[model samples]
Target: MRVDEYNSFANQLQRYASALSRLESLHIRLADGCRLRAYQKRLAQVTVDPRSAIDSQLVIAVTYDLREIDEVNEIVENLPATLDSETLTLLQKVASGSEHPDDELDAPGREAQYELYLGTMLRRGGIPARHGKPDLVATWHNKEFFIEAKRPASAKGFDNRLRSAVHQARALVRPGIIAVCVDQLVRPADGLMVVKDFNALAPSVDNLVRKFVVEQAHTLRKRLSTNEPVAALLLTARVPARIAATGHSSLGTSIQLHPLLAGSIEAKFASSIIPLFAGSPS
Candidate 1:
């Protein structure tokens, strides 16, 4: 995506978030509807780049501001040690503000940093994180808590790494992870539920984020070479069931993938038997 386009998307998101915050304090019937219509109107004012080059409905490009990264780094640094330490360290390294950082020179480098940051954040927040090859072992709560992180919102290109990663993650165990992908607008139709006319509804943010993660996960697994043992998940700002599958492959056996909220990863962990690592702070 072009710099100007990304800026427009970012600005619109900021406005939507702000509007929702204010709407929360008001008491009026159909208030959400009014807010959504206003948000849609404002969004229409922004220039949205065409998705011709990128087939996915999520945000086609991710625009990052060095200043914003710095601010996030400051917040992460100050988070309580009660959060995962290793995960925090990883976040600091990936999300920390840097001037013309090396990763900025290439798409792969940028994607790696984002994946690392997200992986770390999930792990730090008590969810397990791991990379697929080079002997990185996958572990889950009683073999129930499993997840995958994707760069749909940040990466360019139509590579199948997302699917590959999900397949690798599925190798861990039966009833394993619910793979996850991160992107904006899980699907365009999803926008209609959280947004009306043109505005975002105040109560939809949490649900939207959750669905984005779950659907991405689900999509990754559905394309797997073989049936996945676990379910799929898309976690983003919008929730849609588009990625959720109704049945399994030609194996005459059904493999079920689950679409869940990324935040709900914590809840899944709380109910799992997966062994927590010693260095884990959570």
Candidate 2:
């Protein structure tokens, strides 16, 4: 996505959020939706970048990071014995927040975050959404749609991963949202397919990113064209940095999608997800 495109997306979301807030409140059973709504009340939060840390106000709780349990235990062991319980708790929380940020996020946490992302994105398109039993359900054109999102480790088993998500969406019995964070998108024929190998801007035109994005987009268009139950599939891509550095992938709003591939996305999803509130989006 270009800078202007991302900006436009965010701006549109704010407008939708404001519109929904004006509606007569309805009873909703979605716990996740409730929390997100409360966090983004009045469309108060704004994202400068998708990859940056989320604003504190949008998160209901500050979770303790336990990714480095050994390191955390070592810190705990060295604490002074005379410290009061409250003081020790505060210290541990601080250390966990700073030193062990990735620990507590298992698959569920990641899925929950992407679920939040989708609903957040929908609201950006002026759709009202909530999360509960079926991951998420959003309102548009006076109709409710179910959205299910998944983050697999890599694209090696893309079919299997999507199949699992598809099953979940099928159970929802509504216009379903299926989203996938592109962990590893590669054909089985490749030999050394690291994440970095796929770069659209690479000197070699046949880079991995281009191939994967095109193939993935084709797969999605074909699936949607077949009268599949899913309304849309969101594929969030990431580029992991070098190994010696943190084993983290930096995601950005600047998703440099291929023109042909992104058009497939616009046709399948952007065209339908918020049609009631939007005409053809750029």
Candidate 3:
């Protein structure tokens, strides 16, 4: 990506973060019967950084989505206040735009967002998390788990996607790298399809979702070949993209974060932007 495009996307990512934050607040208002004016105030407090230039349309859409959120409880119950601030940084190299179709770049963009959302979730689980050489870096008890998330163009393509992601992750040759494929689970069979042992994390919605993903991590850890232990998983977290909310006043889109997983695999070697090492590399 050109320097200017990176700067622009960085800005868009920030707006997504800010909008997501405000949307969370909006949901809280509906849940508690509190006034939403607080969220509006927060929106006003955020002044767009000129350095991170994003499309004005996205800003407008997010603002509108915040104002128009119905099914407030569904969102309030499901949404988590965990968007990685690291998403706002433009650190990696982008492919040459001239070499790829415009649509081809969208996957990496979504993957970046996925990394931020997943990274934040890890942090919430008491893991020190951030973006790293693999995609996401999670620290727990002095060990690092390098996680790579793959989002195929659609949910049906998960098999191919996981295969590819595993190949990439296996190539890393790092001690703790974990590769996970992210898919969408809207049907019971979808969950079963993603997690070979999906039923273990059941009896509740959250447990079922989380356990299924975690199981994949355990599976991949057992399956892959490495001098050190690694993990591979299948994470199903997407759904058909539709407007979460709509309003004549403003237009916006919703970014939802959901289940994740990891496991092991075999493959070629690839270098990471950040080297994998034991413990926190301060």
Number of clashes recorded per candidate: 37, 7, 19
Best by lDDT: 2
Q: Where is model 1 more than 4 Å wrong at Cα?
A: 1-75, 78-110, 113-145, 153-159, 178-181, 184-226, 238-257, 260-282
Task: Order candidates by TM-score, high to low.
Answer: 2, 3, 1
User: Per-residue alpha-carbon lDDT of model 3 for 31-97, expressed as tens digits?
Assistant: 2222233333333333444545545544443332232122121222233355433443411211111
lDDT-superior candidate, 2 or 3: 2
User: What local lDDT score does residue 160 receive in model 3, on the 0 to 100 scale?
Assistant: 59
Q: Could you give candidate 2's per-residue lDDT for residues 1-282 as a string of tens digits?
A: 311111232443454354333321222122334433333332244334454666542321211111112112222333333444432333323211112112223344334444544554565556666556666666656766666667554454566667777677657665565666553343123221123322321222124445676767655555454455565555444322211132221112122322222344322443454332222121
TM-score of each predicted structure versus truth: 0.37, 0.43, 0.38
lDDT for each candidate structure: 0.34, 0.40, 0.36
> Residue by residue across 1-282, what tens digits does model 1's lDDT show?
000001234444455455334323232122333423333433343335453443333211111122122223333333334544443343334322222222332233233444444444445555555543311223445343444544343323213645555566556653334323332233343232223312222233344444544645555445543454434333322122111131100000011223333335533652331222112221
Span of 10 residues, lowest total lDDT, candidate 1: 246-255
- In Å, residue 140's CA in model 1 sits off its true spot by 6.7
For model 3, what is the error of residue 10's alpha carbon versus the real structure, in angstroms, after optimal superposition?
A: 26
Assess candidate 2 and give its lDDT: 0.40
